[model samples]
Target: MVKLTLIRGLPGSGKSTLANTIDAVHLEADMYFVNQQGEYCYQPDKIAQAHQWCQQQTEQQLALGHDVVVANTFVQQWEMQAYRDLANKYQAELEIVCCNGQYSNVHGVSALTIANMRAKWQD
Candidate 1:
């Protein structure tokens, strides 16, 4: 069995930093949908494909007895439930880290704003 740590936050929310600190396999959703140049260049058709790839990678890491760290803005309840289902199916422990912080003082975005952005992004 593998351990899954789902780090949820918005863009520039330090999800990557947390993933790095844990030394776990980082599955960055932004990398799939956004470019390093901070551009949203992903095609709608490719989103599902990219998510599938992420799921596969997570499973592979778990199979190898490695902890998987999903660094993404999973702000929706359904999104978090999906991860829970995945963990249950794989017999892994699901750990959800809600990366919410003070947006005014923080250099990154806020979880509430991220959630709103995600809702719009999905629509």
Candidate 2:
């Protein structure tokens, strides 16, 4: 069966790590910031664009009938709406995985940013 797994967590959590371990096409909004030199350059102004790219990539993979794993800080439920809709459209089994492990995030997100996300986090 086709599957789409979404890993959600705050920065420093194990979302990306868990997503990597899954046998599927791994995707994340953070990926949109990675330059050709294999470096991550985060631009706050492009955050929404990054998310749109991620969603489009997910839809493309689903269209090709590939299982996909997307890791993002979906702190609020609304952030996941697009993925949920994609899963439905593709008739893929959808799974939401929450990772709360305290592993150091590769992107070096600030504690303040993490705190703000935690404040608005939903179950």
Candidate 3:
């Protein structure tokens, strides 16, 4: 069985950093929408496409008996539930790490970090 770790947090909350620390394949949500040049923003259709792609990638990785770490701000309940359902469907162990913290107290993360992350996912 595969293990799926869902790193959920706000932008600049170090989701990717945590994923890297765990030595897991970091699947950034932005990668689904951003082009190579990082110019075009995410459209509604594109966002949907990216989500489908992520689902497929997760399935593929699990099928290969590899762990998958999803790095994204799964702020919405629906989003988190979707990941949970996927893990259940695949018979993979689902681990959700909520990186929720007060912006004032979160160390090493500044307003600039949040701004930069928002800019990358700007539509």
The candidate maximizing TM-score is 2
Task: Quickly count the clashes in candidate 1.
Answer: 0
TM-score of each: 0.70, 0.98, 0.70
Candidate 1 vs candidate 3: which has greater lDDT? 1
Off by over 4 Å in 3: 37-45, 101-123
Sliding window of 10 residues with minimal summed lDDT for model 3: 100-109
lDDT of 2 by residue, 49-122 (tens): 99999999999999999999999999999999999999999999999999999988899889898899999999
Best by lDDT: 2
How accurate locally, in lDDT, is each candidate? 0.72, 0.96, 0.71
Better of 1 and 2 by TM-score: 2
Find the 10 residues in a row with the least total lDDT in model 2. Answer: 11-20
Candidate 2 Cα outliers beyond 4 Å, as residue runs:
none
* Between candidates 2 and 3, the lDDT winner: 2
Tens-place lDDT per residue, model 3, 1-123, is 788999877765667678888855667556676677865455656766777688778777877878899987676657767678778888999888877554442334467856665555421
lDDT of 1: 0.72
The deviation in Å at residue 103 for candidate 3 is 8.3
